[model samples]
Target: MSERTKTRRTRGVLGGRSERVVLEVLGATVAELAESGYRAFRMDAVSATAAVNKTTIYRRWPGKALLVGAAVEWMRTFVHDVPLPDTGSLERDLIDAFRRRLGIKERVEGRAWARLLAEKNDPEVDSIIGAAVEERSGAWYAMVTRAVARGELPDGTDPRLLLGMLGAIVDAWNAKSPGRLKADLLEAAVRTVVAGARSGSLVRSPRRRPAPRAG
Candidate 1:
């Protein structure tokens, strides 16, 4: 082969190897996160687990935050892309979504997520969590918009606030009790929120002016 052709082939081989190494490191990162959470996750541990040199990981990710962020993004995109189910009823759909969110605590990955949420001082990790929350909020907003169009929800429902409430409820439950969540309790909470939304109680009402006669 010509010198240029040889160089091209060499580059192709090296590119394939680099891609494989990145994948391995990311996979190992996920495993580390799942096994030890972010507080305990270490580059040396990941290097040992992935059988890749620590320098390789650093060269690609630069730091723990970037590596963890990339691992989380990959997991969210490929491994666990949880979607909000649309089953006609807004209550049912929200209950299903919340249920899935609550169920995360039952798995290793879920525990890792919980740990990350609890200890999110790192700016990069916080950014990753913010992005994930935005993505999930968008999905929930789409679901709520559909419900509004179908007359199940009030016209001016705040999807972000509603989602935040639901998330807070689940997070509180997880923090208080770390095992399997009670389905009935979750269902009840979701039903209550949905009822409030339907009745406009959850929406912020406009401020009223005092009567002029009072002056």
Candidate 2:
């Protein structure tokens, strides 16, 4: 098979007129939501982005909620099915993982998910986000599993906790410096996380309750 065919197969993109229309509209929905957020999302913009008329979008989606819901489901698949990288060294693996995730977050496709994280109230969106987060956690866990198998990390290391810490570090840096990528800082952060994991600092510690208040 050609490289393009292999890529599409890996991504699970189906072929059909109906499928094409749905995919186009949903993709446009993601881009529109990412660019304008929920309150500001416009059907006309989605229509323009998809190059399909507004009538076609409405015919399939019926309304914005349905359209966005479908878009969220598409994202769940796209985000969850991402293949993990195994670079032998935990630090290099993590750095590559972080770059892929952050690159997606800064792109039109990933912006939909970023907005989804910030979106609130709507039961449909809330449910989708909850399920997606849990499912996506497996991706992070798989990375840690590989590292552990390779003896890069100790037994019982917690992948979710490690990923959360790394995510926090990235969020803080992005907040201060925006889109700029400082390779030194990224390398330091990955090294720090690897060190912590190796030293058992990132293990899943038991929850502790506060001491009972004195009478």
Backbone clash numbers for all candidates listed? 0, 0
Write one digit per residue (lDDT tens) for candidate 2, span 1-215: 99998988856744566678788888889888888877677999999888999988887779887888788888767675777687777888788888778778777777777787777565656765777666667767888888988878777688878888888998789768766767788889989988877876665547443232232
Candidate 1: residue pairs that collide: none
Q: On residues 48-141, what C-alpha lDDT tens digit does candidate 1 reach at each position?
A: 9889999878887898888988888876874257667999988888888777766666765676676777767766567777778567668878
Relative to the true structure, candidate 1 has a C-alpha RMSD (angstroms) of 6.4
Segments in model 1 whose C-alpha atoms lie over 4 Å from true places: 1-23, 34-41, 119-121, 174-177, 208-215
- TM-scores for candidates 1 onward, in order: 0.73, 0.74
What overall lDDT, based on C-alpha atoms, would model 2 receive against the true structure? 0.78
Q: Give me the displacement of residue 136 in model 2, in angstroms.
A: 1.9
Error of 1 at 186 (Å): 2.0
